[model samples]
Target: MLTRLKDSTPKTLLLGGAALFSVFPLLSMLSAALQPQGSSPAGFSIPTNPQWHNFVDAWDVANITTLMKSSIILVVGVVPVAVLIASMAAYAIAQLRIPFGKVFFLLLLLGLTLPYEIVVVPLYYEMQSLGLLNTRLGLILPLIGLNMPFAVFWMRTHFMSVPAELSESSAIDGAGPWQAFRRIQLPLAIPAIASLAVLMFLSTWNQFLLAIVLIDDPNKRTMAGALQGFVGAHSTDVVLLNAGALLIMAPTILVFLAFQRYFIQAMLAGAVKG
Candidate 1:
């Protein structure tokens, strides 16, 4: 009992510390959001009377409905395209045994190293030349491009982990390559795909920099960009700001929670292999 208690004590402390660290900012934000407008100094304690309606008020004033629509548009457009393209590319790289497959894999992996910030200027010019500026397609195209590299790399690893015998068995049964991939390989990869989809959804949903640079109109801008417009040089509305922050975080949190099991399984699958 003494030995077990000693071993668990440090872990308990660490978990407690982590929980506190993670929850503190959120608690502070909630308190701020519930506070009445003009009731307290910035960064101060909770208001005597908390105003839950501030969330509704902020939603209206910020025109969050339109912002939510824009965010949804970007996410819905990018996630499916990114996943399908990445899955296909990964399948080809992992299963095709094509000539120069290693080279192609390396090139795809190299995309993981390239940061979006480094290419934003050139990307802007390219979009401008393509007559895509200030358009929804313009914003979504760049996000998809930026997300593809990592998506391809991650999905490739997952595809490569699939048993070789499964594909070979399907081939021996006279199934075509596409049939083998579609029927045999894809079903086994659902967990990894779910994990990738969740990650891609979160990244695209939370994207700020690309939205800010690519979209000029407020209506076209994403939640992150819209949130920035809430604060100004002269005055900052803490309650509404926190309310917006909370609203912005809700969809991503719900998505993660819904798919968290797949994410855990994928991570375990990757770890168990190596």
Candidate 2:
């Protein structure tokens, strides 16, 4: 016991220090939010009189309700469709070994390396050509396509990890491919699906560049994009900026807390295994 404790002492201290280091920025932001709106304090100093209403004022001034609604709409539009399509594609490639499966999967892997900047111009032209610019469907469809490479890759890895016997058993019971995927595979892959949903939600919620470029209206952008709009308008108000940031961040944090166990499982099971 003594030897173990001694060995663990440095590791514990290291982890504690890292935790404090990671937390300092959050503490500083929270502290800044409590200060008077117009004042910009340099570091980690607490205010003598905390201006708690800054949050309330920030919400009203920023029209955060509208911004949140826009974000929610995008999340609902993108996440389910992306997850469903990706899950089905992964199921086909991983289990059924669709013809040219390796080539298709390789193309998606190549997409992982394609930067947004490289395709933004062409994407703009395509959206414009399809008369989709500035519309929610415009943003929704592109996000689903952009997310597919990673989502399909992640789900495919998870599906490949599942045992082949499940399919064989279903076959013995006279289940078709669609039936096997819907009944047996979907239930067995809940953890992977939940983890993918969390990731898609986070990415879609925080999407900024596409929002600014694709959607013209400030009212129609994601929360993070709306925050950028908020910043441009309220650059001089430090406290309001921080308050709005925290408000925008709350949903993603709640989602992560809810499905964190599944997220850890997904990571361990090679969600990003290229």
Candidate 3:
């Protein structure tokens, strides 16, 4: 027991150190946010009197209420449709063995290789011609398309991990592929779908370059895009900037914390099956 404890001590210390390293920045940011709006906060400085109202003030200054609404709209518009399309496509590739499956999947893999910046110029031209530029729909469609490669890839992995016997059993019970998908596979895949949805939400929420380029209306921009303007306007006010940054980040953090259990389960499910 002593020998085992000694052996584990190094690993425990390493993990503890890594966790502190990861959390230190967040702690510093929180400390900064608690300081007075115009005050410059040092990393180790605790406020003499914590100003919780900085978050409230920052929200107004950053137009965070509208920014949050816009972000929520974008997330909702993109995540469900993207996850659905990816799931259906993944089902086809992983379960149905669709014709030329290898070729089709390879094309998606090619998308993963191509950076968004490389594609954004041509994409802008296309949206401009369609008169879709500067609209939420413009962001939605492209985001769904952009997210497909990863969403499909992730779902396909989960579907691959699912047992073939479930489909066979459904077929024996007189269910068609579509029926089986609705009644059997989708429910079983809830964890995976939820996981994909969370990832898509994070991606869409933080999508800055695309939102800035494709959408011109500041009011219609995602939270990250608005943050650019917010930061520029408040460049000199470090405390307020940190407070606003935390406000922008809060939703994703809350969402992940809320669904972290399912997220962890989904992550482990694939590995357990494999």
Each candidate: what lDDT? 0.84, 0.91, 0.89
Q: Per-residue lDDT of 1-274 in model 1, one digit per residue for the tens?
A: 9999999999999999998998788778888889877555456366688888988987877778999999899889999999988898888888887789789878867877888789889989999999998999998888887887788888888988888888889889999889998888888889989999999998888888888887789888787765776664214676788887888888888999899999889989978988
Please give, for residues 1-274, the per-residue lDDT of candidate 2 as tens digits: 9999999999999999998998798788889999987898789988899999998988887888998999999999999999999999999999999999989999999999998778788889999999999998999999999999999999998999888999999999999999999999999789899999999999999998888899899899888875777788899988999998888888998999999999787777664544
**Number of the top candidate by TM-score?**
3
- Estimate the overall C-alpha local distance difference test score of candidate 3: 0.89
Clashes of each: 0, 0, 0
lDDT of 2: 0.91
Arrange candidates, best lDDT first: 2, 3, 1
Write out the backbone clash pairs for model 1.
none
Which candidate achieves the best lDDT against the true structure?
A: 2
- The local lDDT score (0 to 100) that residue 272 gets in candidate 1 is 92
